[model samples]
Target chain A: MSGTSMTTRAWLLLLPLLAVMVAVIGWPLADTVGLSFTDAKLVGTAGNFVGIDNYVKTISGSNFQRSLITTAEFAIISVFAEMVLGVLAALLLNQQFYGRTVLRGLMILPWALPTVVNATLWRLIYNPEYGALNAALTQIGLLDAYRSWLGEPGTALASLIVADCWKNFPLVALIALAALQAVPRDITAASLVDGAGPFSRFRFVILPYLAGPLMVALVLRTIEAFKVFDIIWVMTRGGPANSTRTLSILVYQEAFSFQRAGSGASLALIVTLLVAVLAAAYAALVRKTAGSNA
Target chain B: MSALEIENIRKTYGAIETLKGIDISLDSGEFLVLLGSSGCGKSTLLNIIAGLAEASGGDVRIGGRSVLGVHPKDRDIAMVFQSYALYPNLSVRRNIGFGLEMRGVPTAEREKAVLETAKLLQIENLLDRKPGQLSGGQRQRVAIGRALVRKPQVFLFDEPLSNLDAKLRMEMRTELKRLHQMLGTTIVYVTHDQIEAMTLATRIAVMRNGRIEQLGTPEEVYDHPATLYVAGFVGSPPMNVLDGVATGEGLRLDGSDRLIALPVHFKNAVPSGKRVKIGIRPEALRLVEDDDRQPALKVAVEVVELTGPELVVTGRVGGQRVTACLPPRTKLAVGTTQAFAFDDDALHLFDAETELAFGR
Candidate 1:
């Protein structure tokens, strides 16, 4: 076929996918950017376009600043906890043992469950009056009486963090486990003959293999934690004085409940920019590590 | 004291025994090669000595100290693997220095040692690069460098040069011999390649079915193999065997009705009327025209292989395929009948029952 004909054929083949992408992503993204500058409200008439006003108001508000910090804190703590636990689990599971295959299969359950289902599950488990956690703690004498886990500002955010970590840490484990299998067995044996102890061997030898995949996992988990909504919405609805509210939850409230589409759109764009930066860092890490591993 | 000693080493995996009672001792600075084919347990023996694998029953000693319970790292030995196994992420410098750094060697001292080793191996130009960036030969040298930096009591090489191409394998074989001479370290090398065994070993332990068939100098093993298996395994184109029966006078061929006499009396051998296998080296046979000799046998030529500098010919005598190494210029054609004579004293008689050489 001629070059023009070939180009036309290629474009035609891509039409369905391109159309879906435009309808779902491109239109909404462009409309969000355009609507952020207008004074759109839930009940009032549409006001005239006010450039930079929504952004300035949102940036100056104490609520927005608090939510930003909350998102940062949640991402930092939860991603770190997941990374450590996931790597430990992966290392333990990588070795040969009885029931290893069964254990590995079961380990994916937390990650395999849908996000909304996981949130509902945790909500039932954390119910103050009848939850298993409180009953078990009381039976073990660690608690003299049952107390609400998500009803207090001090413990509510931490409870949410624990729930998020339990639900998502397996992602890191899967990536890390695959990378561990590709580590050269001879190199590990060589390290043993080279006089390295177990901890030192893990630090110097095995860690390099896991670093790239771990970074990718970290970027994904961080972005997810930053825009976290479902678990809080289902379990606590960002309650207890807005202590567990994150950027996405705040955006949802501003857009739908309080009827400020412009402020919500501005905040959503900021969140997207932050996630993009994290993704770029992940790409760089993959490049730097991929070059050395080969 | 011997540099290394292995006593009654045995390895059994489930119902199968891979190594059955191996014993070897090496004097300090001796280069010993364990020669065998795959599944012959040469590599397993090396790993047992290196403390990388545990033996079912054995005692291993290096420099007069037992190392059975000691970890591989504390056993005072270094190994060069067949796969090179250089850490893919570390630079060449770090790869060489890692062992020392792990043992708490200061950074400056480790750097100095690494540089000295790189200089000795002529890999100084590639110090900053990772192993993935190096060629096969370069990686082989780096693997050797990783072992050399330790200067341990013994060096265990598990077919270290097998991964290289033929030309590089030959070059590295020579370089290994030179390194052994210069360093004067106790070395145990394993390889299935007989040529590598013949060229590099101070003493060879030829193994078959997890047991050493013979242990001797290269010349001894090459000139006189101990068992029928060794005889068939050591030489390329292999030593030829023909059936024979002892006679009143000497020995009579089973077929072709040829008679040959021995220079010595059968003093210790079972007296006449015994069946035996007669073994002869290919180089011991020579083509002769008719009426040239009394002990020559006539045969139909089957195949001719003219390798440079020498020629190998195969002939059928009494339904047995016998190979002879002749001069490259020797003229012979397939399907032609020719007379070939063995050297007067080159005949080896093996007892059919034991498959060992007959008593002299």
Candidate 2:
């Protein structure tokens, strides 16, 4: 075939996907960008041109600032904890032992559950009165009495982070376990003969193989944690003076709860920009690690 | 004292025994090779000697001390694996010095030793590269540098050259022999290649079914194989065995009624009508004229292959296939009968029942 005809045929084959993308994603994104420049209200007139008024208000607001910090804290702490716990679990499961296959199968239960179901389950366990956590802590004499786990401003976000890690860490473990299996047996044996103790072997020999895959896991979990919503919404509804309100929750309040469509669009776009920046930084880091490892 | 001694070592995996009872002792500066086909426990025995695998029973000693329960690092041994297990993340310099670093050697000292080892292997230029960036031959050199930098009491090689191409394998084989001569360290090497076994070993231990079939110097094992198995395994174009019955005057082959004269020494050794299997190497048989007086077999030629300087001819001799290596210029037609002569000393007789050589 001639080059021109081949190019025309390629474009023809891609036409259907392009149509669907414009209809589904491209149109809405353009509409949101237009709305962000106006003072539009939900279910009302297309208001007058504000010319960056929504963006100025959303950026300068204390709500956006506080929520950004909360999101950062949640993402950094939860992703770090998940990575450490996941790798430890993967290393333990990689050993030769009885019922290891069964344990590995069971490890995925929390991650497999629906997000809403997992959130509800954790809420019951952390119930302010007569919950399993309170009963166990009191029985062990570690708690003087039952305390509100999800109802206090200081403990609510910490409790939510614990719940998030429990539900998501298994995904990291599964990925790390697969990479661990790819490590050659000969290299480990070589390390043993090289006078490496268990700690040294893990650090120098095994960690190099795990670094690339775990970096991928870190990027994925961090993005997901920064955008966290459904679990906290179901468990706490951003209550206890909005201490656990993340960026997504604030966007929800602005757009749906307060009926401020224009500012909500602007805030949502800001969150998207922040996430894109984070993802790009992580991508550059992942490339550096992969290059060195190779 | 022997530099390494393996005392009646045995290993079992559940109900399957991989190494039944292996005992080998090597003096300092000797190169011992464990040679066998795959699944024959040659690698298992090397692992036991290196302390990479535990023996289910018996003991291993290095430098006159029992190291049965000792860790691999404490056993004063180093091994080069077939996979060239250099750490993929480390540069060639760190890969060679990793053992020393793990032992808490000073960085300057480790760097000096690694440089010396790299210089000896002619891989000094590759120290900054990772194993992934290296060619197979360079990776092999790095693997050897890792083992050599340790200066342990014994070195174990588990088919380290088998992963290379044929030309590279031959080159590395020569390099290994030269290294052994220079270093004079006790070594235990494992390989199934007969040519490598013949060229590199001071002594070769032929193994089968988790037991040593034959262990001796290369010449001794080649010239006088203790069992029928060793005889067939030790040579290329392997030794041919023919079934025949001993008569009062001569020996009668099973498929032919004619009797061929037995060597004079074997005439009294075998009683009349005794069954025996005769083994003859391909090189031992030569093309002879019809009126020659030496004991000979009349073979009908089937195929002739010219391998550069020699011709490998395969033919039928009384219902048995026999191969002979003859000079390249020899002219012989397919389907024509020819007489192949043999010397008296080249005859190897094995009992049909026991399969053991008549005179050990």
Which candidate leads the pack in lDDT? 2
Off by over 4 Å in 1: A1-5, A41-52, A135-145, B107-112, B241-278, B291-299, B349-355
lDDT (Cα, 0-100) at B54 in candidate 1:
91
> Which residue pairs clash in candidate 2?
none
DockQ score for model 2, please? 0.82
What is candidate 2's lDDT per residue for A1-294, written digit by digit as tens? Answer: 999999999999999999999999999999999998888887688877899999998889999999998889989999999999999999999999999999999999999999999999999999988789999999999999898999999999999999999999999999999999988989998999999999999988999889889988999899899999999899988878989999999999998899889888999999989889879978898889767765
> Per-model i-RMS in Å?
1.0, 0.6
Off by over 4 Å in 2: A281-294, B267-274
Candidate 2 per-residue lDDT, tens place, B195-264, comes to: 8999999999999999999899999889988889889999988998889888897877889776778778
Number of the top-ranking candidate, with TM-score as the measure: 2
Supply the TM-score of chain A against the true chain A for every candidate structure: 0.92, 0.96
lDDT by residue (B1-360, candidate 1, tens digit) is 899999999999998898999889999999999999999999999999988889999899999999997999999999999999888778999999888988999999999999999998899999999998999999999999999998999999999988899999999999899999999989999999888998999989998888999988898888778887777777877888888887777767777677777537344575688887888888888888777445666778999999998899988887878899999999998999998887756777877778887655
